[model samples]
Target: MADSAPEVPAEERQEDPDVVDRKAEVLAEQIKKSKHFIVFTGAGISTSAGIPDFRGTEGVWTLMAQGRQRPSAVNTLQAVPTATHMALVELQNRGILKYLVSQNCDALHRKSGILPDRISELHGNNNREYYFRAVASYEKTVHDHRTGRKCVRCGGDLLDSIVNFGEYLPAEPLRLARNHAKKTDLCLVLGSSLTVPPASGIPETVGTRKAAKLVICNLQETPLDGLVDQRIYSKADELMTRVMAKLDIPIPQFILRRRLIVQMETTGGSRHQLKICGVDVDGTPMTFLRSIKLDQYCRRAACIEPFTISFRSDLDIGTELKLELEFMGNYGEPNLEIIYSYTGEAGTEMMYLLEYNPQTGEWKTERQESQSVDEDKKPTRRGR
Candidate 1:
């Protein structure tokens, strides 16, 4: 990133109403004519989708500078990508956009369907993994993080990719972004004021050095506006939707894809009861269930993990039984329901991974796992 500069204070500037459409047409033409389009983003691009920018009227830093506390808003854990994110994904999917460089730490770009390798997060991503401070790959016991488990080899802790104040951006992602920015022929700075150092200098570093056109779409003026070829003061979603419409490209809708894997671990005994638990792709536990219907043969008692049943004592382990269970997202982020049906005996123990396909409304089971029972897994735990 370029050296940090004095932060740009937020302000309002209205564009002429008649020139808006003309500017959109110009943008469409620029995009069509350019061979390589690189998109640089900031917090503003996500504001329309519910995340506030850092320098907007209601921006967090703006309010902080005014000697006021930032307003409470929805946390990033629940924030979904906006239309701008989807549009970029479409452009990249069609090969119109070559690369992505983002200063914001929000994980929306990856959530919006961009491949991890195609984009570089200059700041960092929230949904990321970290290695133990001293654990080797082979010695790193891979238990569900939901168990509050520590590294078995060294008892070390993993870390997230969040960069707090006074911390420098990670090196690898920053290098990747700089490489892409330098080679960009057409760069669109979206929803960013370009006030920060290093990153703020990218447009000039790439655009002017390579003789590329710099198109900036933001609500307020930025430090780099004087050098910009086209500056549109507007919301990110509004501007991108119009630009995509002008190009006759439809924004692809993102569908939620979930997976559910249910496993049963039996404690060896004469009358063994298999413990049951299932988790989604994100490691969220499966708790809620759809209405369960029972017949005369299978009499179910109060439902419990691994399912509690009070069938006749004669039908114990080794007796043929059928169990149909429906699991759903606990927090409702994934609203799809998952159904799993097993035709094993009452005490049949096996580790199964069920892939949930929300698009087709079916659960696909995979090959069985040959692992032993884990004593630490709890029904109340959340996945990491």
Candidate 2:
């Protein structure tokens, strides 16, 4: 009789088998033809869901491994579901989903409404406690083994179902996830940065095993970004909303828009034309007519008007005006008055009548312009 089990020599096993398997082709074709699919999600996905994911120096896992306790799950539940979670739920409800595997211990997947049976909680839930045991299919024994008795299975200390740093993956879920990878026609990965082991290896395993067409969706760039067949850069919530629409699911529509405006004012001096040069709220000069006048004498009467001014060509604010005035009677120096008006928004206008005393060689304001509700009339008094 031939040896009951023919053993291949170790030398023969060294030869590489055909790397190109028809299974990969078949899986790809099946994906094009069929609808059933498996999805493996990562921490990156939950970030949009408002639940923190871990694994990097900044990741939730990293913090926990560093002796920091994870936040309570109650807060996560109160937080709103992200577009990514809604999309996953839509995929499951439409029956396009075969199963979902998540490494998160936050239990957010369940809270998002995916059926427990359809999801493989790879890392287990943080809320309830249990310990890993068994071989081919690891068994989880409840934390409160029983008030009536102790842990009968292993009699070892029961622990939380959550897998931690330095802990190996629970066997059963890992096995199921592998089986799903080998058989799946389409594998959609969402939000995971795909850095950590065992889980990160899933995409490569599926590719190597001739399993499925891989689609990886994430925000920041990842190592597997170039390796996947399809890549999307977006928040989970928005991405899922689009996916749901494609599947004929009714989703609410929302968008954001904005507008702004600004205004300014400045004073101008001699030899310079007052020009509005800065950008306006709408990028155009304010609509208003401008008027300018020069070389006018205002010593005779209230000869100035609002939006109007008078200046001496040779003298500025303080220049001596020498004049010999022989008063026939005892009287003081003449008083000068100037009047000005402006009709525009935010009503503000003023006028000043001044005199240059040759005796003191100083300029003194004799009168100031004032505002009135009615149109101003010229002053009847004369100048000095």
Candidate 3:
């Protein structure tokens, strides 16, 4: 269905370095002077992260049109945020970027530390699923919007959040994006071909305003290139790196952070069961952990949800339990060890925060005790 969309010539272009530098300086000035600055992004911004774009030379649509094999790409779950993604995060941290609108479902922008409230992912996120009454992440692989899981509240079927061909866009994200576009005085377009309507038209709206300025940075010519105030035929990462330097803002490095909630339940007598799983900041089930091992009990739970292990042992009030966690290894992260001490309580819960820096090959861990253990409690669902 994606191949049926409109196509542009697969011609890539790069502007001279000197010209790009000069334009970056001017863009930096515009960012500083503008009151309401916003950004619109597309799949091109993720190409550097091993994700292929739609209209590029080796893009999915381009390959389909040329009768060539589809280009192989890194799994969206394994890919890390690119330089451009991190740069945008830094910009938002400084309050220079008011809002962000993106057509990408890769979830890089959200993983790059951007707040969910500050961005509108118009196309929807691959990692998210929607029920009629709520939206959350699904544990199993979802196909054609069917997650094979029932809604906890209404007993309804859960659906994938991805917007397919002929499907109407989600209303809330579209409303927020249009509102931001109407109020934006400086709109920065990155990695977009400006071909897809609705999502593409948001940037054009800002460009049409008398007091607004629009700048586009992409490797291919966009339909709105001639009308834009500044057009740089360059990679999003390259141009954003220059712009950050001109603005004297340091681009932050990417750090992978995960939270794990561990709970222990007494089956009977000396028998006990321990459960462990990864969770997001907002308590959504995050399936980054591939396997878990309890070395003391010689038990392992891998390739399955509800990672629990049952064992019998005489435990003291302050017994230490060691767990070896094997992650997905997308960023070459090594297996981590978690040392949790038991409180000798039937429903005791412990939280662990793990941070990994791929650049330095370093890891940090923090442990906190939770007061409540509600197994039936569901994460607060959010609407896009």
Most lDDT-accurate candidate: 3
Of 1 and 2, the candidate ahead on lDDT is 1
Query: What tens-digit string does per-residue lDDT give for candidate 1 at 231-292?
Result: 88877777788899999999977543333343332333433343344443444343344323
Question: In candidate 1, where is summed lDDT lowest over 10 consecutive residues?
Answer: 144-153
Clashes of each: 6, 13, 0
User: Candidate 2 lDDT, tens digit per residue, 154-255?
Assistant: 233434456655567877778888878778767877767676678777766665544456776565566776666666655455555555544556642111
Could you give candidate 3's per-residue lDDT for residues 222-260 as a string of tens digits?
A: 888766899998899999999999999999999988889
Q: Which stretches of candidate 3 lie over 4 Å from their true place?
A: 1-10, 131-143, 147-158, 265-273, 298-303, 310-315, 344-348, 373-377, 380-384
Worst 10 residues of 3 by lDDT: 134-143
Judged by TM-score, which candidate is best?
3
- lDDT scores of the candidates, listed in order: 0.63, 0.47, 0.83
| TM-score computed on alpha carbons, candidate 3 | 0.85
What's the TM-score of each model vs. the native? 0.67, 0.46, 0.85
* Candidate 2 or 1, higher TM-score: 1
